[model samples]
Target: MQRTDVNTLGEFGLIDHLTENFVNKQQTTILGVGDDAAIIAGGDEQIVISTDMLVEGIHFDFTYTPLKHLGYKAVVVNLSDIAAMNARPEQITVSIALSNRFSVEALDELYAGIAAACKTYGVDLVGGDTTSSNKGLIISITAIGRAPAGRITRRSGAKVGDLICITGNLGAAYLGLQLLEREKAVFKDNPEMQPKMGEHAPYLLQRQLRPEARTDMVDTFAKEGIVPTSMIDISDGLASEIFHICKASGVGAIIEESGVPIHNDAQLQALEFNLDPITTALSGGEDYELLFTIDPKDTEKIRFLPDLYIAGEIVAKEDGVKLHTKGGNIHPIKAQGWNHFGE
Candidate 1:
């Protein structure tokens, strides 16, 4: 038997290679593989579909992450991708690959979270597949959303001079994971210690166990009569997401390092962990906040919003993406997206 290293083809290359060979037989597949969600033609509106796969151990640790919270997190992540497209999620198909180690009651608890998220988001579960797996549990969720004609946002729509806006705080989720892993290690060595997690209680834990998607922001933007020139969720951190918007939009950006938001607890935790809060905000994944570029005029409308921040302004292609540091140093903002494939 021959084994090929998956790393031989980088993430993008692999996606391009696999998707390139397949021809779209259905006209419904309006777009695929390259963006946040695959666009499908639909009646009176465009349908957006996004799928996310989470593998136990690789994507999460069942020991610390409860089954119910994991279930909700999985759906939220997928829905976050849909929200990145400024689409309203209407339905979902959840597929699970599980081992016999999980009890029927355990599965019930997982679905309870899923059911809760569905009700909270107003999405219906249409269909899915359940299969056996020899390894850890695997959950794949495909979320379907809808948007009116010309309302759907894509990564390719950014233009020079567009204002880059990010919703909610950043770095908390990454720091949250760091805190959990550190505590888990401590607990393993001293079982009697009872976990000395003081200030880093709920926020960090909630971030790791149950990060919420900003679908409400999507709805708000729509009501405010503004369409993001381009958008991508901050799942892969601010730096990587900014790069995605830049590359797709064929523009550049100058994001203010100071303007990037970081929660107080996240900041304190990062300091205690000896991690730079800015770096964590830059490269940390799974924040699930929406990072988008809007027309300069729209900036005025949202500038006063509490959670949203005008972190940067898009620049010309030649300028390239960069960050303006606190001391006034301009440095290139590199792509530090999640390297799950280790490219």
Candidate 2:
């Protein structure tokens, strides 16, 4: 038999390859795969379901990540998926697999964070499973949300001439991860040395450690009477998410370099690390901000929305995905975001 490597397909590719043969047997499964969340028919409203898993040493580093923050982040990431569907997350089920290394007090601290997230997001902690693992801790959370029939957005709704928009700033969380890893390496070399994250540490670290979902943006859309033509949360970098939206919607995009939102602190840190701010913003993952497209007719509706950036526009698929750089250069925008299978 021939051997094939999982890394060859990457994460999303591997998912597609594996699930290609599965057929949806239920009519309620409005969406099955290849989206932020699965949509199901539910009487007056649609039910949106999203699940995410975080593995120890892979998704997070305990050296810098607190249990409380980890719990909150685990929940937030899944809820972010729900938000991507332009839905309101109402419940979450958290399942954990941990080794004996964790103590009862540690579990309490972790649940405290989970409780905090539940309270903050107004979601209920429904039911979940717990089991033991020999390797390390693992958390899997499933978030359930609700959306009106016509208002639920998906990745496949973008159309040509639609305005591409993003919520909040990008790249800070990636820089925060870099900062934490750098500090961790320094500590590994010299235990007596303390981390010097400088002035930007708080903001950057907070972004990486405890990211909040843009569920409020869903509310903003409702208040403004703007239903995005398409939406996806920025989990896998702006460029990658753009690719997802484009591929799903059968359209292309033109991103303006100047319109990409990079926090002032993120810009400084990127330069300090000898990285391009725009490139960092493009490729850095885990922003958890929403990337969505709105009909051109609805442009005025989003004009006054807070913290929103009109970064680009939907175009004919033949145009491909290109970035109009501030330097008067236009080039293909590459999807160089997170690849779980990469070494």
Candidate 3:
């Protein structure tokens, strides 16, 4: 048999091929293997299911990425997808593939973080699979959630003139990863040297190791009577995720480059890394924040929102998606984001 490279299939193609013949026997599987999560038909509320996979070299590095945090992150990443759908995650299934290198104690530490997240978010660990792998450790998590049938958000609903908004700040995670990589290099050379994360400790280090999904923001919308016209999580960076929303909604956007939020510590870290903070904010992945749009009329609702910021507004397709530079130049916002395969 001839061996084929998986990258040739691409992520989307692989997903399609793997799920094409898998029929959903239950009527509850109204939507599956597509969209942000599987939308299930239920009584008054709909159930949403999402899964995420993290491989050693691709998703994270075990040398610095402690097993405990890795387990927690694997769970949170999938929940972020659920939150993107404006659903409340209720349960998760954690599956792991391990080699002889890991001991029973290591597994316990990993589950400790998983249990911590479940407790923090009020979710349960329903069930999952465990297997031995010849390579490094792998974690795959599936989150099951719920929301009112009409209240669920999707990627294909933004209308012209809707305001584009995002929660918290962006770019920190990518820069944080860069910092970690630098430290790892330094440590490799001098094992005696302690990691000098310095003042950038709390925000950057926390972002890289223990990122939290914006489920609280989804819950906040309920309290504030706000429903996003379209929604996506900033896992693939703001510029790329904004493209996903625009592409799905058949609309375009104009984001004020100056209006995008960046934290002070994150800015300093970016400067130290000799990176463009704005570019990082635009293209950094794994932020796990929410990017959404709302109607012009409801703009006031989020105007005073403490954690949310209006980055821009949706425009006609002819207007095209763009970013207004500080120099007042309009440039097309290309989705030159992290493509794990290749550009």
Largest lDDT belongs to which candidate?
Answer: 2
Pairs that collide, model 2 = none
TM-score of each candidate? 0.86, 0.88, 0.87
How badly does each model clash, as a count of residue pairs? 0, 0, 0
Cα lDDT, all candidates = 0.81, 0.86, 0.82
As a whole number from 0 to 100, the lDDT of residue 148 in candidate 3 is 95
- Deviation from native of the Cα of residue 61 in model 2, angstroms: 0.7
Candidate 1, number of clashes: 0
Worst 10 residues of 2 by lDDT: 18-27
Q: Give a tens-digit lDDT track for model 3, residues 28-61.
A: 4465555655554466788888988888788888
Compare candidates 2 and 3 on lDDT and give the better one: 2
RMSD of each: 9.8, 10.4, 8.9
User: How accurate locally is residue 327 in candidate 2, as Cα lDDT from 0 to 100?
Assistant: 96
Error of 3 at 298 (Å): 0.3
Ranking by lDDT: 2, 3, 1
Error of 2 at 38 (Å): 18
What is the C-alpha lDDT profile of model 1 across 138-176, one tens digit per residue? 999999888886889999999888888888889888877
